[model samples]
Target: MEENRLPFDAVILAGGRSSRLGGVPKQDLVFHHATLLQRALAASAGAAGTVVVGPRPEFSLPGVILCREEPEFAGPAAAISAGLEALARHCTSASEYTLVLACDMPLVQDAVAVLKEALVPAKGDGVMARSGDGTLQPLAGIYRTTGLKKAAEELASRGTLNNGSVRSLLASLEVQPVTVPAGSTADVDTWDDAAALGIAAGNQDKKPGPAQPQLTWEARS
Candidate 1:
């Protein structure tokens, strides 16, 4: 690892149903000439190892370990567990920290940078991103490997890993929140969100439609 960089692994959650986006996979959505998933991969390019947790995409992804949650689309918590297991199984050495990211956020690179910088001086279990609007974004956080494993184990012990909320997985961790730039934590959950972020559906073939009325960012549910 570079002297200025910390050794870490990355787990990207890409298994959402996209129910609000007419079943279009958000990972396939394009922004700035790259799919959302590709953008996420680029954001975590510095990690020693990366595991993408979700249904395997049709296209090839070089140098990435791909896996799915036990029940498939179970939830972020379950997906995270599977990613951690994949990392342990495939990587020769474990990193001290893990980056957990949601692929739907196109501008996550900014958040990652902020979290990583904050982590250097942080004494907590990890550092989470707080959006400019003050919303805590756990999915954009970097966490201590041991802390994540412990939390996953505790959730599994209670039989709640599957379909469990990300909040539950981080409930026991001591995380410092660092504010990120505006729109850094914005995620594409709906067509309106895609428009707000200037993303286009990758599978669409229609010509560009009339300009969409501007919409404000919606809080993640």
Candidate 2:
């Protein structure tokens, strides 16, 4: 869309088979009273259009464009490349950037802004999420059009190097870190992890126990 004014496109990485989450897609799981995919979409409001990259040929998403990984089921790199290519094709502007976000991260908002701040036009690539101590988050990073094309081409020619992992591509990129805020990197992989994160975040939303009121001995006073 208007990538010129922070209008970069968005990619929702929902390609994971999610075997850890009982062999079902984690994106379809309930989170914060909504499907994980729905929450991810809501956070991508700045993107002009969104694409869901998955392996299921019959996959469907209402109001959002759907595209399967080019060499469906290859791995994360394949999914990322396919999503970027799809975004490029759909976008009229040839120079716009694309933000790649994983579907399982329910607390990764403000990522786009962090990326925008770290983007150095002279550097050719934008920013990516890094942990508080600076660990790159490739799946939740901003990718410039040129960088994305290069990454895709490399992936194609190398037959998906680094075991077809997005981490490999991210490591090779000229990346900058968007230091994650405290408690913002919670990703729901195993059901256990989901439960833990849910409990933590849910607890944060509630007020702490107040001072215990004095018990009244008088009956029905």
Whose lDDT is greatest here? Answer: 1
Per-residue lDDT tens digits of candidate 2, residues 12-66? Answer: 8887878776676776665555556666766676677677786432223444666
- Which residue runs does candidate 1 get wrong by more than 4 Å? 1-5, 202-221
RMSD of 2: 12.6
Can you write out model 1's per-residue Cα lDDT over 1-221, one digit (the tens) per residue? 24136799999999989999998888778776567777787788788888888766545566688888889879999999999998998889879999999999989988888787888889979899998778999999999999999999999999999999999999999999999988888999989898888876554432222332222221111
Regions more than 4 Å wrong, model 2: 1-4, 55-63, 120-124, 161-163, 199-221
Local distance difference test, per candidate? 0.83, 0.65
TM-score of 2: 0.78
